[model samples]
Target: MFWRRWCGLFLDQKRRKKSDATYKNYKHILGEFVDQLPASVRFIDQVNADVLDSHMRYLESEKAAPKTISNKMMVVSFMLKAAGVATPSKMMELPTVEEEIPEPYTREDLQALFKAMTPEERVRYTFFLDTACREKEVAHAQWADLIDGKYWVRKKTFKARGGKERQFSPKSHETRLIPLTRELMDMLNARRKSSKSQRIFPNEWGDPEGHFLRKFKAVAKEAGLNCGECETTISEGRFTKHPAEVSCLTRPVCEKHYLHRLRKTCATFWHEKHIPIRTIQSWLGHKSLETTQKYYVASAIPRIVPPPCSYSRRICSNSSTLVLLSTRSSLGAVRPEAESRVYGFQ
Candidate 1:
C-alpha cells in the first residue's frame, strides 16, 4: 500500500480507540511530514534514510524546536514500524535535546494568582497547588474520591507505551492518596454543597474532561504574573484583543507558572517543610526517587535566625565585647538553651 494509504489506515485504527485530540495531533504531524516528501515517492518502502535525513533538515530550516522535531520523528518511526518497515540504522542520530528543569511557583506567585481568581477558580486552583495532581488527574477527580479529608487520585485515562490509549487508574496504575489541607477541605465542602456534577472540578457543561489550563492562564494573566499585554488590532475590519497576551509588566515573568508548576510548587512546599524525599515521591506519584529528587524538590536552604542571648558582662573583660557570629544549623534553627551555652561569654 502507499504510505499515505497506510497512514490513513493507522489513523483510523487509532481513532477507534484513541482520543480525537491524540488522533488530530498525529494526523497533523504526519500530514506535515508527507508535505515535505517528494511527489514521486508513492510507497512506504520508498521512504528511505536519505528521505528522512532530508526531512529532518527541512524541519530544522523551518525552525522547529528540537523537542518538536523529536515528536514528529516518533510519529514517523511508529508509522514506518507499523507498516513492516525498519527504520534506517543511521537515522538514530537525531538532535540531543536537553531537558529543562521545572521551576516551582513561589508562594508569592500563588498568593497573587489566588487573589486574582474567582471563587470557583480559587477552589480548583488551590486544589492543584495543594494536591500536586497532574492536570488530567485533577480533571478526573470526583466527589467520591474525597474520603476522610483526603483525595484519592485514580487514573481515568492514560496513553500507554507505543501511544496506545486506555482507561486506567493513573500513569503507574497506582492510586495516590493526597491529604487535604483545611483550606482545600473548606473548598471541597463548599463545592459539594452546590455541585451537580460527579466530577469535583468540571466545565460549565459538566464534562469530566475540563479545560483547567484555560481558566488557570486567565487567572494568571489577570494577576499580572505573566509578562505580556494584549493590544487590540483591527484586521479585516474586525477589532480583537487577546486579554491573555495583554500585559504591562516591565520585568520578565517566568512563563513556567502553569498548572504543572503548581505540582512542582506542591512538591517544593513539602520539601521546604522537611518532608522525606521518599514520602514526597509517593505523594507526587513519581515512579522513581531520582525523578522526585532531581526535578520536583527545590534546592532552597531555609534561613532561620537564632535569637540573641543575653550574657552577664561581669564574666567578660570590661573593655572587650564578645562578638557572637550568628550561625545556623542544618535544620536552620537553634534551640534557645543551646544558643546560650554555645555562645556564652566567659
Candidate 2:
C-alpha cells in the first residue's frame, strides 16, 4: 500500500527528517539528471561514475553554483547508496569547492535585524543560526534544558535515540555543549513568563512546523534581517536588492545570493572571532573539519585584527612592538628573557 511519489524508494520518515526546502531543492536538482535520462538510466544500476559526470557537466554549463552541485550530488549519491547501488566517484570533481566569499552581516544589519525580531523569535532564530541547531530543536527549546551558562541542547523533538522524546546535545554539535553567554540567558528570562509551555517557542499547532524556508524568507525580508540581498555597485552608491536577484532595491544593482549567504555570514562572524576550526566544525555540524575548512575558504572570514605591518604606531602598538623586537635582535639580545623583562611577556 504505497502512495504516490513514495515508490518505496525513500521512506516518509527520511523525507520528513529533512527540512522542506532542502528536500525540495534536492528533488529539483535530481530531476535535472533523472528527467533527462531514458528509463534505463533511471534504474539504480545505471548510476555509475560516467553517468554522474555527465550530470555535473550539465550543471556547470547551466551555471549552478558549486555548493548547489555538491548538495545535489550528495542527494543523488545518498539515494543510490540507499538502494545498494555503488555511488560513482567521478562526481567528486565538483566546481572547485564553492570559493565564493561569504558576506558577513554588518553591525548595522545585525542590530536592526535583532531589534526588529520579537524577543522569542530573535532568541530562537539567532541561536539556530549561531549554533547550527536543527530547525526542530530551536522550535522546542525549553527552560529546563537551557542551563543558565553551559553547553546544552536537549532534543525534545526528533527523538531517534530511544523511547525518550527529548535528548540533550549542544546547540552547535547537538552532541555537546559549547558555551552560553548572558545575552542568551537574558533573552530566555524575558520570554520566561510566556515559557509556561515546555517549548521555548510553541507554535499554536501542537506539532513542530516542518516547513519554514519560505516563511523564513518572508519574515527575514520584512525585517531586513537576511543578508541575502543582492548588492549592486553603481555610480551613485552600492545598495542591495531585496529578497531575490530578480528585482532591484535601487537602480543598477549587482547580483548576490541571499539566505545561504547568511549561513556563510554566520560562519564568517564565528571564524573572525578566532574560534577554532573544530569549534566551527561543531557549530556548523559538519562531521569533518575538512568540511569546516571549506567554509573558512569560502567565507574568507576577515581576521579580527589587521596584520601588524598594516597598522601604524598610532593605530596599533603591535607594530611598534615589532619594530622594537627587530632593534633588539640587531643588538644580538634576542632571548625571550631579555624581551620579557621589557615587554612583560613573562
Give lDDT per model, in order: 0.66, 0.50
TM-score per prediction, in order, is 0.74, 0.57
Candidate maximizing TM-score: 1
True-structure lDDT of candidate 1: 0.66
lDDT of 2 by residue, 1-346 (tens): 1111322355344456554545666666556656655555645655566777877777778787888878777766766566665544444565567455556555445444444454445665555545445565555566566663443554445443234353334344445453443344445677776655665666664434444344454445655443445553334324843443233343223243234445566566556545567766765666877767877675544454432211110011232221111111222211111111112211
TM-score of 2: 0.57
Query: Superposing all C-alpha atoms, what RMSD in Å does each candidate have to the true structure?
Result: 12.1, 12.2
Would you list the clashing residue pairs of candidate 2? 151-177, 153-169, 155-167, 228-258, 232-254
Clashes of each: 7, 5
Question: Candidate 1: worst 10 consecutive residues by lDDT?
Answer: 309-318
Instruction: Supply the TM-score for candidate 1.
Output: 0.74
**Candidate 2 global lDDT:** 0.50
Candidate 1, residue 78: lDDT: 82
